[model samples]
Target: MIRGIRGAVTVTENHAEDMIQETKRLIETMAEKNQIAPEDIASVFISITNDLNATFPAKALRLIDGWKYVPVMCMPEIDVPGGLEKCIRVMMTVNTSLGQKDVNHIYLNDAIQLRPDLMKEE
Candidate 1:
């Protein structure tokens, strides 16, 4: 079976280093929480708020040890009237035996406000 894991993170600024680090952190957390392997990932879709133009978040995936071949695409998020800023969202599709309900969704930094209900208290 294939499953989609959703994740979001916010960068303090629009710097390229911040974008790369935060995106990598978000993806790593998502994979760790869901026990996903790079080889099992089908593809990764990323969207960043219009305010973020420093760099492409997909660059983070390529820097991962085994994710060089994982298909990844990046685009700009819809700019709503009062949408969140400097936020990066990710949707990772992977081959897994886990059920939909068992999948874990990750939200970090200021992006946690995007999905408080899905977050489990630590």
Candidate 2:
């Protein structure tokens, strides 16, 4: 069986390097917390807010991880009322034995407000 974990990241710059580095950091954090091996990732979809257009966040992760076979795509998030800008959202489906309660979803930076109850407060 498998489960999905959702995460969001805020990029400091629109450069491919920044997007990739931040995404890499976020994914590493999520996987570590949930005990999810990179090989367990079934697929990953990332969406960046409309404000960012310089690079695709997905490219950053795939390049960094060398997970060329893992299905990854990046799209622009539609601008909506009260939506956060410069945000990169990731939805990863993983084939794992972990139960739902054990899965850890991440919400970072301004995106933390999107899921206050689940956000890890420090």
Candidate 3:
């Protein structure tokens, strides 16, 4: 079955390194939380806020060893009024045995406000 995992993270700056690090953080957490292997991913779609233009989030994923074969797309997020800035969001479609309800969505840092219902209490 195909399952979609969603995640988002906030970046402190618009630098390429910061974008790469935060994007990696968010993707790693999403994979860990969902127990998803890179080979199991069908496609990955990432979007960055308008204010973050230093780099494409998909570029970071390409640097990963296993992610080279995965289809990754990057786009700019809609410039909504009052939307969070310096944010990178991901929607990864994975071929998994888990049911949709069992999938975990991750929202870290200020991005947590994007999906309060999916955020678990630690």
**What's the ranking of the predictions by TM-score, best on top?**
1, 3, 2
lDDT of 2 at 23: 85
lDDT of 2 by residue, 1-122 (tens): 87999899887667777777888888778787787776888999899888888877777666545466778888878889788878899999998888886678998777777777776544
CA displacement after TM-score superposition, residue 110 of candidate 3 (Å): 0.4
Off by over 4 Å in 3: none
Clash number by candidate, in order: 0, 0, 0
Candidate 1 lDDT, 1-122, residue by residue in tens = 99999999999888999999999999999999999999999999999999999889999998889898999999989999888889999999999998898888999999989988888766
lDDT of each: 0.93, 0.80, 0.89
Q: Quote each prediction's TM-score.
A: 0.97, 0.87, 0.94
Comparing 2 and 3 by lDDT, which wins? 3
Candidate 3 lDDT score at position 98 = 86
Look at candidate 2 and tell me the lDDT of residue 4: 94
RMSD of each: 0.8, 1.8, 1.1
